[model samples]
Target: MYKQFLIIIIILVTTHKSVKGQDNQHPKWNTWATWGDQNNGTYRNPVLPADYSDLDCIRVGDDYYAISSTFQYSPGIIILHSKDLVNWTIKSHAVADITQISPEMNWDRMNRYGNGIWAGAIRYHKGKFWIYFGTPDEGYFMTTAKNIEGPWEPLHKIMGEAGWDDCSPFWDDDGQGYFVGTNFKDGYKIHLFKLAADGKDIIKGTDKVIYQSKGSEANKLYKINGTYYHFFSEVKADGRTVMMERSKNIWGPYTEFKQLSHAQNDMNSPNQGGIVQTQRGDWYFLTHHGDGDWFGRIMSLIPVNWVDGWPILGKVGEDGVGTMVWEGKKPVSGTKIITPQTSDSFLGTRLNEQWEWNYQPRADKWSLRERKGWLRLYAFGSLERNDNLTKVGNILTQRSMSTKANEVIVKLDLSGMADGQKAGFTHFGHPAYSAIGVHCDGKIKRLEYNLKGQVTEGDQINQNVVWLRSVWGFDGVSQYSYSTDGKNFKDFGPAYKLMWESYRGDRLGIYSYNNKQEKGYVDVDFFNYTFAGPQKTKK
Candidate 1:
């Protein structure tokens, strides 16, 4: 009998330890879905399998840092850090508030849906980290910090003109700074410009168009072995392809070079990303599959082969340009498996690094302190002054991971919901944004799904607490369901198609807004997410 009692105690202790370990770690939503790290010294394409659109990577000693375009999301330009190139952690958002770039980016304006911060480049220059980007409508901007996990300086408008995109800054060996970008307003002309010594302004009278083509953009300039290599993307007769040019001089009469990558890619058109060389002197090209669907631009790490001074991305073919490669031995190893955190318990004073606001959020409308351990979003009218869910402010979200299948479950406390407050979970993307929400009207608490402004009401929800869910398939269709008891979920809306709108993928979001009055609020208890993961490929 004592032996049996001791065994029972051992079992209880073991179970308690397991639970305690989980409680100490950031909650993981999926048992498998999030991939890239194979845990076997190899990783698959897209070191990050999500909407890290128009990404750029650079190596600072042993550290690998990447930046992605956040578009209208506030605290813009997502920053990430990885010990090895395969796994990553969200460091922080580079831009604290994007309104400094343009008021249209303001939540009250809600005009720059897909227009803010386009393809940018992150470079550690002269002991400081510099980020430069262009908005299609707002010209060019730059931000800087001494540390990667920053307190970055407010964005400075480097160029005030418009219609340019995808910019990069390069510091020549002689200490002269140069900028390269596509002046899309000028028929996709890739221009080279001299930069001011401070790297905050584009020196006037130094702009020169070196190349022009349809959709010729995503420019990055590099000087290797005394030759300046210009890498950019062009929409070919086949599709968007990555091409190159080289010149002995930063300014040229440059030699038109070979294509670096083919249009046929596992990442659709594998173009638009930065190149990095490992500590071992090996090279890799981290590019995004530009021809992404609803998942936005998923990233891929392709091997870079240097032939006769030309950096070729991916596997080279008989035709000579590179093609997509899906798996590779990790560039750096012995690092722990790290994926961006997703599951939020709302236990911290600050929102998770994985979460970003739809736009410049109203500071007064959301709180982590209002409720001890919940995300509290206060009710307010759409900043754009309408009923569009896309226009509503203070919607906290994270990129929906790209996978065969993934889902999100969110628990919401609706007791504080005021009359006319719309609050709940959403799976919103670029044109086909939709949500499963709780609408509080008078004494009637109803359920509804908003699919691109078409609202369909479901069964009346009487509970002050509810759980909402959205499941997405490989085909980019999302079906939402909800449960009042947090256990049984019933399908609430039709399956909705998701599209990559404004160059971004669908995101899992929790929001609260009221078109009528701003008297109520909703507290998000937790967000549990999961996905079907990619199996590790044996090297």
Candidate 2:
């Protein structure tokens, strides 16, 4: 009896410890998501493990706002908000219509894949939020709003001169305004211009070349502690590195210059972003490494230390150059776990904050009021033969998370589909694309997979309600599946390797296009996303 009692007590103790151990594990904001602040008061680098490139961050009171470059996606200039620098969520966008720049996007069939709205800056001055960006083909533009989450003002073309990119705006304490930008056409030099009080017009004849370097861009200007600091990224022999030049006067014979951080550890080309200070006095550099893969330009937050009046990013070594930190103390003390927006239920009146179209969607082609709790995408006529996704407007898409494995499922209603129309889900990127959807032919609806313009037909579906799913593995391999009842999904096509193309990463898209005419449509009920992979822990 004594031996049996001891055995029972040991078993109970072991079970209790097991349960306690499981409970003690750090709670993750997202299990399958790649980058975010770990809930245990620590954060991993690539704080956001996605392609939020050309980043610029600012702190307003206790809140932080960071804006990223969206090449051709509208609404453009994605703005993310965070309470702590580690955890972030999508707040709003700066541009609403792509046609505001050119009608070619909507009418001329000119797909601006990797060109529109590249690398701008955001600033908060006086009582409003100002964002300035440039396009490779069209000049420079600016937009402002009273609220960060806003109805931003229309795009105002400030400069019509070609070949300017990566511009930043700064306002001095003396009520003077200055604009700095890189001129790729004019010997790749950095130029500074004096701006009027309204920040809409440049004071004439104030343009001066400040600095010249090979591939120098991503300009950010700051007046810190009675000194003017100009930060930008330049291509070095080893790789792209963050560079800084300082002066006592805003425009000048600026003297102090140095390379702050370079490709260190696994962070390749960690350059081109701004720095911000937390409420507790700690500073961090928000950057995107230029070593893009299937996922484009992932973002990281590097701790900064001010040594001799300069901000040193990441960790300083014996040589005094900083290396990227994969794990570090939380910049702010908070257990709140937040992440960027994903997954959407069409039940809402407005589209979810996560959704962005390839270009300005034809206002008359898409509607939410037609079917309550459903997103109805009308079949717009395609611009080319063979049904290319780039030529099709209203291709709703969102950024894919950087994880080992992610699955997206969409419930689509095909009752409204017309003949000669194809509507379904797509894993889209230029140079390579794959889609699985229902293709209507007269009265028959057939499931089909289009791989890089090669069409493969599948089993016919009789029902109006169908479910489609796409799964992505860590190795960048993707597979497609479909179901009629939502429970049993059968794999339908060969695995596809996702690739980076045209300056963008792989994006999951919901698309519809017609070869005959703009007649058919598809009703998307909801999009559900789930992830599974190794949990993040301190290394």
Candidate 3:
């Protein structure tokens, strides 16, 4: 009887803890906290891994799969899986090593910032999954795998057309597969072509102009109740709006287009989204919005309804935007504490998937050891900082949170930075800013923090060896200080506001940078970070 009672108590305790965690990670996306009040519903940003922008999603049975535009960033294709479209987790990347694509590329020109893989397509067909992507400056390509985790086959060039971005494939119910893509430069026309049965090549004779867009890039098609709907973007009177057209046949004499949603201050780019039918037989649209950050391009959802055989997205009276869809007919079938992996202790065999290098990291940038419990970042590259160009070593970073105020404290043993070697914390905006440990001219020094364009200067405290602490608060504010005894510290100087000259968003994190010729390393003990509300205290 006692054993049964104990077992019941343990189960109850575990269940309670689990519920609390779910509340934290998977916050109510439907509420105003997730999406803002611009629309009739909630409007909080950065839904669905804001880190993955230019996203494309699909729903199969109960499983939801998504892939994002991995422009210049290697680990080119990130695949995410979710039972509930609102909650997703990265399962594995379709591509891991950048070298697999090109030996000369290292997040430099080939993975050039803002270039590469604009938007791609992922479709499962006839037991195989395929990814069709194109470089805006280059051409279109395709690759396939029996399993999505893939031993993804070598990339095969499908077309070298210049003026295209997102390309998609539709397998018709009548037993044929057709490819559709946006030609943005020439005519903004949607071209269609039938693919060979083997799926390896497009039939040379099947090319035809199916639809023309006033302004659209990401496009997809759906057939409902005998009407084919071509959902795409068009620059309407109010700006760029999501518009749709319908036809009785696959190859449209598509009907006149009607605006579904308007882009309000780019808060509703509504670029590419997928229509998913829940098991309950209800329909929903999964989409994205921009927060103006490098990775702040976020995910959103809206309840989609098929009316009069044409899918009417969201309700009419409601503001036509990407409304956040949080809850569904059912609760997420599994645990809800869904969050990307963060807070690495440097003891793991490899960096967590959540962390990404600022540029293509060289093989000699850093080293890790479990026994020592630290990540050693070696000094490399000159101080000629261009956030998109510099090859600073050992930069493992994550997207800045939307929280009002967040603080990150990195503990490091900087006893190894010799004269002419510098190392410490960096907050990457644009022009890449940082505060470093200084060993200059036979004196232990701390230089004013400045890079590309951002300027944060600390008091010239003449101390050779010291522990460092740099903090970046909300609203582009920043500060730094050092502790000679590793406990008692002095404020470096006046608080400075970080401004990225050419940077895209408010992305800030810890980084180790070296601006010397002789190679050296900074041993990071660990990083501890916390998010504080505006009312919380910071010392």
Q: Evaluated with TM-score, which candidate comes out highest?
A: 2
lDDT of 1 at 141: 93
Q: Each candidate's lDDT (Cα)?
A: 0.84, 0.83, 0.60
Candidate 3 regions off by >4 Å?
Answer: 1-49, 99-104, 107-111, 146-148, 196-205, 223-227, 291-295, 318-335, 369-372, 382-394, 429-448, 453-504, 513-515, 532-539
Ordered from best to worst TM-score, the candidate numbers read 2, 1, 3
TM-score of each model, in listed order? 0.91, 0.92, 0.77
Worst 10 residues of 3 by lDDT: 35-44
> Taking the tens digit of each residue's C-alpha lDDT, what string does model 2 give over 391-411?
777889998876767899999
TM-score of 1: 0.91
Among residues 3 or more apart in sequence or in different chains, the pairs in candidate 3 whose N, CA or C atoms overlap within 3 Å are 34-44, 35-42, 35-43, 35-44, 36-43, 36-44, 444-464
Which is better, 1 or 3, measured by lDDT? 1
lDDT of 1: 0.84
Q: By lDDT, rank the candidates, best first.
A: 1, 2, 3
Task: Please provide, for model 1 over 86-105, each residue's C-alpha lDDT reduced to its tens digit, 9 standing for 90 to 100.
Answer: 88889988899899888888
